[model samples]
Target: MDSIRFENVSKSFGKTKIINNLNLSIEKGERLILLGPSGCGKSTILRMISGLETITTGNLYLNGKLANDVDSGDRDIAMVFQNYALYPHMTIEENVGYGLRIHKEKKDVIRQRVKEAIDILNLTGLEGRYPKELSGGQRQRVALARAIVKRSDFFLLDEPLSNLDAQLRGQARKELVRIHEMYGQTFIYVTHDQIEAMTVGQRIALLNGGDLQMLDTPHNVYHRPANIFVAKFIGSPSMNILTVKMDGRDLVLGGQRVELPEMWQKKIHEKEGRGLKMGIRPENVVFSREKGPYSVKVNIHYVENYGNRVGFYTEIDGEELISIMPEDEFAKGEDVYWNILPEKLHFFDGETTMSIGYPAELS
Candidate 1:
């Protein structure tokens, strides 16, 4: 196992800056995920680590040795791209043991390693099949088998599941996790899908517009987001953000007065009536038929049922708010009351886009 580190790393292409002073560390045997939207530099970071892209500045270390100058083939890393890059003319066994063949390892040793990898990936019966004869998932397993058969120091997966269907992606994710467990090598994966990042990564590094936003576990990133961008980006049903003006102990939202939590009220009192943006997740919104501390009557625009839960698409005071409920409970176009709990609410300064109501000590 090898530990990977990048310090003050920057990369550029002509006039465009792709990565900016990015610093990250992947411990030995860690599963680190680089997550962001398209053009956010996630793939750039992965390529830089694999020596495919030259860094404009900064130091990169692999197992405590400088690696920025290392050649891609000498880096002792296996890369799996989105498109399964397999040899069409070679059988699965040949494709998996090609490196060993080129290096001229003992034939029996190569056979043993290939058999073990095929068994682990559940590709044993298809070893004699050519690439064209196998399914997409089977071909992907061949790619994985080739990567693991070499016993490389690290695995760099660049959205390897992106080409598979949703169901296949799910199955492949489980297989990847099983592979990680079987071989405790550091695995660095890149993906634009937040769901993939959340489910696969031990810890995720979030990027946006060439900047690193937050690096944390999925629970902390979802529940205690470092900034508004993270809070808005990580959740499936995006968090609801409302712009409101502070009015002493009350926050004014669409001409309606709403009381603030004591901690938030104290901070607003110190700020002196400044406007703020408050975030609330969809699951936190409680639907009711009675009056509450902060009640809003909303028109139910639509309801989408997905198995066990339903997503109620609605508009409140001209702002969109989605509420998730039990699938069998409600109907569309029904008038309903909604309220969000204080603990579930997050305050952000409108100017800085930074989280508010957090203990000053934490800052």
Candidate 2:
């Protein structure tokens, strides 16, 4: 049975919908990330699971039991919030052990559990320091430690590392994975950061404007997005999308024509004369000095140095595209040859903005 299942779940506040027909299943001991932009209902989904927010319609099941009416405190779920919801007056030790104490645990047991959580979170030295005395990252860890001590079957985090610096956030991500492995609990983490979703999640449930966009393993989500929204949302520089018309065995992008590979020609032959959108990741756009079979000449309008890699920005007709290359080989205003492999190409239906399926090899 699934640890948590949302059966056509939806949420609304004062007639304003926040979550729309979300059907999802989270396996026991799986780390699932709810990822999307702000106001996309990722956090709202987390809250619904935690019973902090009520479902407007449909059912929620926890461990195969309907949980629509379960009390938040009776759910046996521990959550870490984005704000590091720590008590200002309580020391780190007190805050970490407060939950256990409230449950009527013996003092000795609370002490031992608090110590273990503190040590795991690297908060041993600051046990007596209050939340106000701690750094943002430290407080965030303390909040996590509090949830860890609960040893609940379900663990939820709402952007718990958003307050930390980049380096600290990276470290915290590793720590979270380690903690999850140790406990083997069902973890539902909500974040707008794609890096966190890509690295921490066993599977990602991406949302957009209250609708579930895609739910799949990170690799598949990155490589085989469900629609145009997902394809543009997951990548760092975002995929380059252009309108193209299928002409016989060629795809016409503005005035430029690209002869489709023999295999792709057979696959999309039915789409001939139809309008479609072509997508390619910036990293997949190869730079070459010599012309290839699929090569196109483009003048670099701008160049951005990203330390390890460089970004070459150019326009084909009126549409802008970015290409990431390892080294800075061409200067701004220089005309360069670029090509995309057949396997790297993504096609979307023009009218619906949904994927038109990949080549046979990738299908």
Best by lDDT: 2
Can you list the residue pairs that collide in candidate 1?
none
Root-mean-square deviation (CA) per prediction: 2.4, 1.3
Top TM-score prediction, candidate number? 2
Per-residue CA lDDT of candidate 2, range 1-363, in tens?
699999999899998999999899999899999999999999899999999999999999999899999999999999999998799989899999999999998899888889999999899899999988988989989999999998999999999998889999999999999999999999999999999999999999999999999999999999999899999999989999988777777777758788988887776665544568889999999877888889888889999999999999998879988999999998999988887688998888778788878776776
Tens digits of per-residue lDDT for model 1, 93-211: 99999988987889999999999999998987888889999988988889999998888889999999988899999999999888998897899999998988888899999999999
Q: Candidate 2: which stretches are off by over 4 Å?
A: 271-274
Q: Clashing residue pairs, candidate 2? A: none
